[model samples]
Target: MRKEIFSKKIMDWYQANHRNLPWRKTTEPYKIWLSEIILQQTRVAQGLPYYERFVGAFPDVLDLAKAPVQKVLRLWQGLGYYTRARNLHRCAKLVVRDFEGHFPNSFEGLKKLPGIGPYTAAAIASIAFREPVGVVDGNVFRVLARIFGIDKDIASDAGKKYFFSLANELLDEAHPDIFNQAVMEFGALHCLPKNPKCDGCTFSKQCEANQKDLQSLLPVKHKKLKIRTRYFYYFIVRDKNKMLLKQRNGKDIWQGLYDFYLIETSRRKKTAEVVKTDAILTKASILKESRVFRHLLSHQKLLVKFVELKLHSTKEMNLLARRSELKKFTKPEISNLPKPILIDRYLKANP
Candidate 1:
């Protein structure tokens, strides 16, 4: 029954070539969920070490639930998308408080938790608990779309539904755990988005897209991303060896993460233009107007410029400081503080 549509050769390839990751070795649902969350917006190579660190530090779901939010955010620093970390912490607490520190055994139950969406729940349910469900992440979507020559825009709801139905048909329920993993791994390693090695691929002969020479063009997306351009003016205000660091609050990226004094503008402003509007810049000594750092987000392009300001006295710095907007961190303390990648880059180079 399993052999009708499911590929046995892909399982063989998975057994032979799958990376020996730490999370894969564990049968614990907590560890599996942790790995999935870390790898959500992250890559395998970059996420592996963070996974190991998290597993070691928390050790159990109970530990993670009891740990401070700051501690969790610090551990998750530099991972980007701080919301994942926050939700992970929140989910842990909910599990502890509601479910008695046990993850939900079923996909629907898992989705009720803070950050466990359909893809994540499916991965955890099938891989950890042997539930008969298939994951349809970006990798899985790519694999199914290419092998079956599916030309529908995968980003659409209809396309996702069609692919999920096809995936359900191909899933070997008796071996759901290995089947889902194999399909995702096949996409990640062999049925690549770019230049896939179709000549050596096990499914090359049977693959529809490969036969049609349309692997690169098959998995289409309907909506073009609307990338907005933003300008940020960062003031690195320093009084002696102490500098101001502020925690990002409100509905914005890098919440719970620390960064320097920030002033966001609709358009990039020249130093002369910025100085005329603000009296502080006219009084404070502008050390250097650093080079513009271009940062690319999923839907935004940020052009950032850093200006270092040195005050004459401690009183002068204190007078200008907005306690709500700033907190002073010593030179040594700055190194210990976790910051966004943009700020971190500037610190390392300048120091």
Candidate 2:
């Protein structure tokens, strides 16, 4: 009975009112998986162009798998959360090698992929394969909590478990694709984070949040973020017209992106400390001017200090010659070449 109502109302609404997204037109699991990954830390508006770009560049799993990691990273530049790109590349290769360039159809099989967790696996399984699995993303969580009047803190482990169980129970097996899309679409379009359109909402009649005048309070989440400040001194070394850049090597942010040679300190360092740091500047033969900038992340505050060094010769520094030459190097280029951001900023400020 409940299933019938859910199907009749939500599925009907979905068929008539679903947004015209590119990924919705096909049941290609690879494409769906790619969209899901790209849309994870990104919004629909921002991710759509990147999705189109990736699809155009590598039309198939085999193409994505065969492409170099650097090429993939270059395409994924400015998207942030670069580990997602790395994992996607790794997963693509694994799919090609083991699954013959086909995305795994089963939830367990999908889970075995490099970056796919339960939510992603369930999303691909249900949407791509019409499995009975339910996708409980942030949108679904909000909609469910409001509809069911669940007041548990969504951030807690117990609350999440309860929500997952409830979602599984509410999932309509007959039309998993339409059901999944409908719920997510409803939340995204109507049951939003703020000022939900309860008047137009299909579930407004029975929505506990609306009835209790607690629409904004239904999806309870307590954020506990530990924000840390980091100071980075980037050395932009140049010889003649070419500037020096280097690939970031670590398990932190901008892992595959390009940056200048960095000298990180516990606290913000002065110009004297930056100039006198012999160990840090040993790589560069000559020193020019130091410029400073700041780039912020979700939980990180980066105080970027740029020190432009004029190299005696390009022979020892292993740097790119011209701006055009920097285009040829990708993620792997990080290992051998320097980044453009550091050089661009240095030239902009100094020259």
Candidate 3:
């Protein structure tokens, strides 16, 4: 039944309706690999322009391998999940140094590269090389769970193993890319998170979830996320035209973006107290005023306080090497410098 279902309906629907993305036009393993990595945790519209910019800047593996890590981070600045950028840089260098500037063709070889996990490796192998391997992701999980009426929690280890096995069994041997894309496209377009369009769906006739009237309840997820709240006090210290800024260093969010001198508090602090704290006033002679702002992430809530200080001496703010060069520098540029979402807001407000 699965084989028949694939041979007739899904494949035909995919060929007719799949979106013509730029990545689909090429068989170049490097290009395909780059697209896959960029699209991770990024939407098609947002990722598409970055993909074009990256390909234009570094057309080949060797070009990316040789480019500075800071430049790569700058290109990837707004995308969020900065680890993807770091991994991409590392993987490119690996390909050039170890694989002769060519992306590994086989699944095993592809998996050896940094950040090439199971799904990514499968995608590169099947989409670029046409290898007979299944690419199972969230979209696939939703489609398969509803189609087969599997109630196991997708977040569980056992459930993941079961789905991968089923995906492997159902993958079409003749055209793995088309088959994989078809199921994923169906899930993305029709079988959505809310108010799914099930009436005219190709699989409606045979879909077990539809027959049982459980369209929204089949794919169970068990993971619960704990959001942590953080307090940030950023010094917008300026002497005449120059403001103080520094490159963030350490293993935390916004690993390679530029930010002002920061003071993290245990909880939200009052405005008068925020300005009076030793961390805030030690570097500046006078504080004109302070502005309070808040920024939110998927798992974080940040309360930011911006202290606008007119410094006694610009040299005290050591992060700014040359005070005269402040106007020449552009705000919010994507570089290896650490950029939290709050920094972006500050740039937009100040720019």
What ranking emerges by lDDT with the best candidate at the front? Answer: 1, 3, 2
Candidate 2 TM-score, C-alpha based: 0.66
Cα lDDT tens digits, model 1, 1-351, are 245545587788899989888888987999999999999967899898889899989999999999999999999998888999999999999999999999989999998888889889999999999998888988888888888788998988999998888787788888888999999888888888899889978878878888999988868878787999998888888877789889887998888899987778888889657755666656777899889999999888999999998877787667667644688999899888778899999998898
Candidate 3 lDDT over residue span 234-305, tens digit each: 767665555567666588777766777677888887755765766425545545444667677899888787
Clashes of each: 0, 4, 10
Model 3: per-residue Cα lDDT at residue 178: 83
Number of the predicted model whose TM-score against the real structure is largest? 1
Please give the distance, in angstroms, between residue 56's alpha carbon in candidate 2 and its true position after superposition. 0.9
Q: Which stretches of candidate 1 lie over 4 Å from their true place?
A: 1-5, 225-351
Candidate number that wins on lDDT, 2 or 3: 3
What is the total number of backbone clashes in candidate 2? 4
- Who wins the lDDT comparison? 1
Give per-model TM-scores: 0.67, 0.66, 0.66
